[model samples]
Target chain A: MEKETHQNIESIIEAGKMNELRKLLIGLSHEELERLQKLLNDPHEFSNEISSLLPYAIRKMVERGEISVDSLLPFVEESMHKSIQKNPQKLADILFPVMGPAIRKAVSEDLKRMIASINASLESGFSFRSLKWRLQAFTSRRSYAEIVMANSYLYHISNVFLIHKDSGILLHEASAPESKALEADLIASMLTAIRDFVQDSFSNAEKGTLDEIQFGSLKILIEQGPYAVLAVVAEGQPPADYRVTLMETIEAIHFNLGLELEKFDGDTEYFKLADKFLQQCLIKQKKEKKQKAPYQLIFLLLLLIAGVGYFVLINYENKANFKRFITELEATPGYHISSSRMSFNKIYLKGLVDPLAEPVEEIMKRFQKIEPGTLQASFEGYLSTEPEILQRRAGLLLSPPEGVEMKIENNRLIISGTAAADWEQNLELKIAAIAGITGFDISGLNKKITDLQWIIPSIERHRFLFDINVVKLDSLQQIQFDSLVQAAVFLDAYNQLYSRNMAIYVRSYTNRNGNVAANERVATARAEGFITLLENAGVKKALLKSQVLFAEDLRETVSLRTVHFSVFDNKPISR
Target chain B: MIKKKIAMLGAFAVGKTSLVQQYVHSIFSDKYQTTIGVKIDQKQITVADQDITLMLWDLYGDDDFMKMKPTYLIGASGYILVADGTRSETIEVALQLQEMAAATTNNAPFLLIINKSDLSETWEIAPETILRMQQKGWIVLLTSAKKNLMVEEAFQKLASLMLNPY
Candidate 1:
């Protein structure tokens, strides 16, 4: 090491090893260098090269959180301050372009917040105020939604902005008449810088972006996209769904002005139609706060007055009607009010409501729609639940028949009262209709309404032997005519006593010795001859009814060929 | 089958209606009627073994009184600019109309048709004026609706140019 330590001795390039060193180095080839130099000289190509990585660089910067838009906001404010102090006349011209957009941004946010509030109110249950608004909205000719906005929405958008995403330059603007005075360019730059700074700083750990900023009551809402961002400032929270509208605007700008936007050099004259997109943001302002406010309040107040009036009236009507129902129920017979109280829609009557007294359930039903399964009838009665026993007992105790006596003995009804006639006559019709009526004995009744009084209710058959189908009566048969006369008199007495029209039914049967028509004629003639004899014996023609009955056995058997006599009342009397 | 829309653009009362009537119906009407809104009519013809349906949008002529709407020329494959040879100003109007049509049709193939050639004695348009347009690479034709001369050929020329752009 101490023999030759020449520090300046160059062994690599001194021996014509420059080519070897150049080959080992990482320098570009000559042709490639020339091309690169040319590319560097061209400004368009240089910018184009950087532009390719602009999006990625911007994203990386945003993710790092090392930069923020606040850093550049001072520059914007300084520039405007300088203009105001140094070049006052140029201030208007400098600020003219930014005014519309600046105000529009604020208004857009205000309008958005109002919309969000309205939606929130609707999503929640209706308060008194909200319900009033809903009713007003229904009555108005306008749509319910429009009326709701008119009532609940207090903020509006006076202007809107469309700014370039990369350069933060105002592309186009829309504004109401009142927002014509503002500096939109400076605001756009400040907003962009703020967005950038916020995105780059504290937001580095995550991909989340700043969505809002607050200053006093004024607020700003930021909506982000891949290529652009929209900032809105307002006094309240913006509508959550306004993002869809803003997104659509961004999409349209991307589609229609995409090519232009990429190569844009701060010229916005071509984007004249940007107002069309921003007009959506410029919702008509709520006219004079006091004026619109009073009108809505008055409407709500009037609606509330009417609603309260209706509710009071209905409550009064229901109370009055319920009182009347209670009074009527107490007055009704068979209803005993041991304890009666009305709890809401139910009427609890603990009194003894006699089941037999006009039927408690039926009494409740008489009043339509008043009682629907609300009647609870508990009656004090005999141990038996049978309807017959209940009916009999109730009838005897409530409205006992006049001058009538009843005894249910041996499971057979025994009655001595004169009104027992009425009860006995209804035995086959109504009293037996009860479920548990075993049987009845009217033999002890005084009036004898149950007496077998109609012609003894028996068929009195009188047979006469006819010789060779001749209908003439022989001497022996003529001897029986007195009995026939006596039978007619007896039937007449039965009719008078029973208070009915009892007729003598004489049915004559003919032998089957000839044609049916001829035999019927023969039998009819014989019946006529017998009637003449009965008429001479004092029987009325209306009381005598005759008919010819045909039978083949009558032709062979002498006993079978006969005239049958039976007495019957045309109208049987129950009394 | 292919649908090719064509426009009839011209000056006010410049025989545009007459030319369309002649080309579409092959019939002549002596009535000098002014068209109002665009009158749309269609006709089918065979060209190069393909059926071509021609939707003829006869746009109302452009004038100081009634300027035609250019939206009517949208989706047009070709157009015919009709001018009355008797009026030289109508030729200028035809050029203005051609500009409007070209804007909407995306410069579709077109023909400049000078109508009313049958009234040659009363002609006001100069021959040099038409020659200058021809030199500027314009497809020009002289048609007479009254005589029914070269009217169909004028429309066919534009149609063929559109179908076979060269």
Candidate 2:
């Protein structure tokens, strides 16, 4: 019966019908068939061949929802224990070549569930050793020693993988390496393939205007086992020569593969080593994940905090900008008609004011005083039309006298009317009060009449005196009029005495001498009087300063006969 | 505050150290000291009401450094590539450094510092050559550590460029 069952199983396998094989096993006796089935399933259960099948089956089961990850885990654990008991060595042997595919399949099949399970178990403080044991059971025979060693290798490889993966993803989104490289040739080939693919895609996408394609690749060789390659293609073309040079990269990788494996051994042994490595990786990944979880969470928390901070900062900046706008508006010069309608930070003002007026300094100063930094004003009123109203108001404020007429047109103030002398100041003030007035025309204005000649005469006299003393003289010679008067006092006294004597002589000559007779006597008397005056003034041997000679000297100088002859005829007529 | 990371790269024995020493220490060293890996120093400065931290990296003088490991050039905000004023060959190195920096960082702000300007009589590189290089998108500045000419200015300008980044 066992032979028939074996033959039937062999036929089903030959026909490539696994379902039939399973169905045929049910027909044999339970004890014998169970033994045969266990034997038949042992290779698939413990070997690397099962590595391929397991992923496929798990994927299908997951897709169909026939087996949840929680339900599948126990079976995986049992299989791992059974394989290890059956042949720990064989299970270890299959791991190296198949580790790449196995890991890839595992990740692809149920990345979300695996991540969740790992995270959940990690939170519960389940040790990495426990996780490694589980992974080893799913993939191979679970030996404690193999699992421990495998955990360490996996830790190193996963670290490398994560670092390279981050770099690759940052550089290019679509092409990232799948594994780590044990061989230099694999690294080279992976780099070249990535470079070429990125260059082609970038050139095609950018229409050939790009300069360089930035990308990264992952190449992992399970020494003496299967090779896994991952390439990331960037969106731009690199240099053409670089692409050309990359074609030989695959050949180089192949060469490096030989060198890498030579450092190890045959394929089966290599896979066994890799299997141990995978086990180690699983444990290490679990441990590292547990260790890094807090950090990742912290990083996420920090990012969230930063995001909130940025948002608040942006809001503050916007508010500040709004406040600044309002302040600028308030600082401008204008009548604020809608000041109450706006907030302190968003005040608005409107009114008639000169747009091109001078010294914006005045406007700024006024605005500063009104609201400090909170107010800004701008003039939007019609400067050309409002000058008349402004002028009238200014006239009223200045208290102009009743008759003075003032008008403002186009920023020009016009005053054309007569005003009392007392109203002159008031008129000037009225014109000055008009806003935006560039100039004032008061051509027709007149002042009240008042007498001022009496006052002017004295002022003129003083001015004449001042001019004589100071204006006509050089700066160095100019002196006070009183000083000059004091210095000339004696000369004036002497002149007065001389004038009196001469006047007496003249009167005596006119009275005493009739006609010609009296003239001769008067001349003699004048000469005598001048001499007497000089003598009285303390003069000794005095002579008249004038060119006219005295009477005595004149008689002496002239001959007596000629004088008598002239006097006989003249005296006869005068007497 | 954003810290600007800048690098001083050049060929062997181009007085990069002298320039950095003059600006940082205000002293001139006649002796030549070759750098090994990378040396880092920092300075605080202000521009337009913003405080900025300038992180200056003085790389080694070996020409083969770029070829050996390009990773050292990553994360640079700006670069100052120095060349010897007396040697025209150094200018070639400067050009190569520019290319490498552009390739590494996608054209970050870069300036070319031509050192040893105190020896103008011995200079074989003409101003025209520097101008030509500048026309090709390289900023060239003449400097002399001994004279303290344009050394601080080079750093200030590079820091400003890094801060603005546009």
Candidate 3:
């Protein structure tokens, strides 16, 4: 039977009849059947089973702390780095959305910080502290901004040096970006020397190393490790926790680089790794204060506005005054403004001006709104034909005497006064040559008559004596009549000298020794004879007129015949 | 680049400071030598395509008035023992300073520089003494601070020895 079963099984296996075999072992070995099932899966079935269990396996591993995120970070970073290196565009596309706001946020933060710093500095710019900082900057050979930040910050580590304890050599150094670079190698050695010097001098320092060294505003904080020392050069007051950070950094260096520090031997190549720790100590914190309102800027702005307003107001007034001055000049009789402009706080004018015109300085003095010496004027001299100028010109040239008055009216020169004869003659000669005078009138003038009036009195005083019955002249009477003729000749000469026509009268007087008719007739005959004699003595016959008059006093006193000569001016010229 | 501290040691008025002045930048004045007993300077030199910076601690001259402090040479990688060629007694002082520096730095590399070689008329050190020192495994060099002769060579040689010590 067994041989028969074996043959069947062999035949079934050879014929690929697994269904019959499954029936054979279905209840006998289920565990073996499950193993066989698992072992007999196809490629697709294997893949599907693994996919189902992968996520759960990973989750379990993560929960149990068997696989850490730290372990996966490098793989992810490496994969991303490779992907970016292969196709940078894809990485850029993925990060674009995040980068835009990130960049904007970072830039805005930096800008806000910068603006705050600028505002703070500007506010302090007017303070006495700012002046002190400026002086310190000059004396310390440092930048003003550096000095300002030095004083403004609450605490700042400018430079951090890692030095070997035994060698006193610089292992590594880190500095703030804004800090000035120093010769760290030299400084490290010098610091070591100073430490050694202190240790040597003070007996109390045997158990302790230098912890702090104060240099004005700068403070050196020294943290000693087993093999190395960390020195931080700081400004302002560092918080107590700052020492903790420095201590931690120094301990980390000693722990991580213990073997290297022990074997330093002036070779700093290995200590470069300590820079990361050293840089962590270059910390800073700014002082906090309320944001003050920008009053100084506002004040400056107001002052600028007030200054500009004052300048503009002054400019406007000056312009108006300049216009008024130009107008005044134009309206004047002898000034003409051709070009006018303002430059350099000055008014420049070019034009023509009559010599007799009102002075420009006098006009300028009237406008106090304009600055002194601000009027630069260039004027060419010109003769003006205006009436007022012409009148002035006539006065200047003629120099009329005190009593004489000259005026210009309707282009005519009118003169009126009592002038000397010579001056009157001069007026007649020069009046026509004056420019702008169409005509002249001197009709109101009078010439003073000097010696002509005296002639009348002298002529009247000459008298001739004649007998009552004798109409003929005797020798003595002829001599007396000659005297009367001479006096008559003097009157005629004066009349000619003065260019006047006057009448010389000859009169006869009779006494009471004769009858009235006979005396009158005799007197008339005597005057007629006297006139004939005066006329014959070179006096004009027309100028010598005869008259007979009875003398009452002489008629009562004595019977004497008298002939008198007198002269009267036809047109008397006042002296 | 490598940095090393080197000391200049000798008797008073031995031209040790003058040698450093010729070969390095003296940021600290000579007054520092009188006050602090040491003036520090630095110089950069190239040897065998390697750049090295030497921190020179010019110690105040050893004399009865101001003896050099061994603390200044605590960390020096090398030293230059200077002697005035015009004074034979400075050679004995230089040898004494060498022993002190050796004790301080554990026999660090050094060079014996006979300075003021240009003052030949006043030179009092015998050449046979220099030969005797050289025979005793001392690297001896003649230098002139005034003429700047062998000043650079002496520093360059010292820097090379410091970088690649025997």
Candidate 4:
């Protein structure tokens, strides 16, 4: 029963408020309406004060795909324009920090895109400069990027400005962070003036704006829009498509801000987002320049020319230096050059210096700059002034037969050995040319004696010794024995040269410390051992003999306390 | 990563190039060889958790032959002064070259490597010489390119020296 009474009261209240709600609010104060008016004018005030309500509204719009980055760009621009229009002067100052980096970023990205396009065009396909690069890349089997990096020029947009197309007024500007600030208005005005002058002076046939101007390393690129113009100061050779970017930005501005700009006044506040738009067009970059490729090639070419020049110069210098070194060596006497090579960077030498010449130290002092490794030298065994050296040189120069041996004594060379032919006629002339060789002797030399007799005095004088009072050989004595055997074999071979048997004699002696009979016995055993040794070493048994002797009382070393020899020959002539 | 140039200095045939080849290529050659020019090689390694690339310069040995090219020593962060253990004078040469290398790198870290350790019996460099070098506060190592002894360690010590100077 109470629930029915409450339902009737709710219906009567709802029915009364539906008609009275609008009438009751319409009767409020002006301040309340003004408050509502402010809320309507700036939705941010209401939504922001309510916090997450604004986010929720945007989220709902986003969920329904009612908002996008592109669609929001215009709105953001509009809001910034409204705020900037409220106070142009302070707004510009206030926006400086925020817009500075933004403009730089935009300009940097646009420049990079343009540079990439240009570099791609240069490296991807073929053109004049690129053609040359491609041919080199083909020859070197390298990639186009390498060739481009090597030969291509790097470029950068140092500064960019957006100016009112007709007024040449600076609307917005951006520059590299470290770049010095330029008078944007002055540059824009100058460019506008130049453009106007060019159009007036040369546009009689067709109407076109000045597109580019150059000053040494700087270039000004211009792109005209219906409402504004973009003047870019580039430090290097920017890509041609850089103008395409400027034109696109201008077209975007025209599409988004054309209506407001058309009703333009002197106010720049409506273009508050221009800095952001300009920044979106920036770019900067540089490539590695080894400076090596072209320089190395050029250096190689120069090296080729210089190589020949150096060769000629060095040839003359080498000849002169050769002469000087030879002259100095000859003037000092007794220095002989075996080999030498003189070059610009280095000089190589090998020679023999006689003691009769300057001291090696003195010779080396002349070559203070040359290191020891380059100046190779040794002492000379013979000087040309010596008779032995004279004879030797003559012998070598004359090349006498094997049997011909030359001996020099007291300035006279004795060429007494036999020769294949009596080349004495030529020998006299050759020998006379050799200094210190005053005369010749050809007497003792016989040409092929059908019967020959030879004696080896040095081999004969060799002693084959024994240990004290003992005939058994020790290790030291055995060494002498083996040597003796070897000598005997050589002697026998030499004797065979004349078809003769070399006689081997072993005369043994004892020091006076032992009894005469015992010593004689020991001496005899030592001589017999020597005979056995020679026989074993291939000496003819018929050629061996032994003799025992006695020596005065003086103890001798074991090696010298025995029989020595005197070798001679008996001939069986092969001739 | 930082690139530090390290030069090899010593007398002729003292195994400077061999040390570099062993360290870089991980291979040793028994044959003794010499170089006439600066041979540059690169290796990447980590020291104290920092990546570093070593630009090794194998220059020709200096002695009775050519003088060491001072230009090659320029910009070096460190150096390896090698000497033949079989040749005592090579130690003196290494010391002298160290002075030269020092001038170029402003006395950067260096190691005195007495190379040819495989032929210890033939060593003519006196123990006193090595002791003297050590006494002078020089870091000394006995290396054998033939046996690859201490080759990698020598390079690592130098790398660490470059990373943390003093």
> Could you say which candidate leads in lDDT?
3
Candidate 1 local lDDT, residue A434: 40
Best by DockQ: 3
Write candidate 2's Cα lDDT for B1-166 as tens digits.
4445567788888988788788877889888888766555556667666676565666778566434134445556678999998988888887777787888766878888899888979988886898798788777888999999998889888877766767
Model 3: residues with Cα > 4 Å off, grouped in runs: A1-80, A83-108, A121-132, A139-141, A203-205, A265-272, A290-575, B25-35, B64-69
State the fnat of candidate 2 relative to the true structure.
0.00
User: In candidate 2 chain A, where is summed lDDT lowest over 10 consecutive residues?
Assistant: A561-570
Across A1-575, the per-residue lDDT of candidate 3 in tens digits comes to 99999999998786556555666767535567776687567777777878989999999998896886756888999999999999999999999999999999999999999998798868779889899999999999998878977977888999999987866778899999888889998888888878877776674645778899999989999999988999999999899899899889998888778898887666688988888899889889988875999999999999999999999998888788888888887888889889988875788999999999889887777777776678889999998888889999999878888778889888889988876555777676698888778899989876643455555676677766776655566787777667666656655655665767778777677655558888778778888876676666666797887877656754354335766666776785444
TM-score of model 2 vs. true structure = 0.24
Please, what are the lDDT tens digits per residue for candidate 2 over residues A1-575? 99999999988687656555656876555566777778677886556556769889879987896766756678999999999999998888978789888899888879888887687557433776677576775687544433443443322122111111101111101111223223322232233334334444465475432223333321232111123222222222223343332223323333334343333211122222222222222212333443545888899999999999997786676466545544654444333234433354444445445443333345445443334355454555444335544564556565556667778766677776666555676556656655567677888776532223222232122111112112232344234323322222322233343332111111111222246554555444444443343345444322222122233445344321111100000111111
lDDT of 4 by residue, A448-566 (tens): 42222323554565664455755666787677667666666655655555667667777787655657787677778878876776777677677677876556643544444656886
Task: Report the C-alpha lDDT of model 1 over B24-101, residue by residue, as the tens digit.
Answer: 787788876787665656666777776766767676778898777654564467888989999999988888887877
Top candidate, metric TM-score: 3
TM-scores for chain B, listed for all candidates: 0.95, 0.92, 0.92, 0.95
TM-score of 4: 0.29
Is candidate 1 or 3 superior in DockQ? 3
Query: On residues B18-44, what C-alpha lDDT tens digit does candidate 3 reach at each position?
Result: 788877743223342342456777787
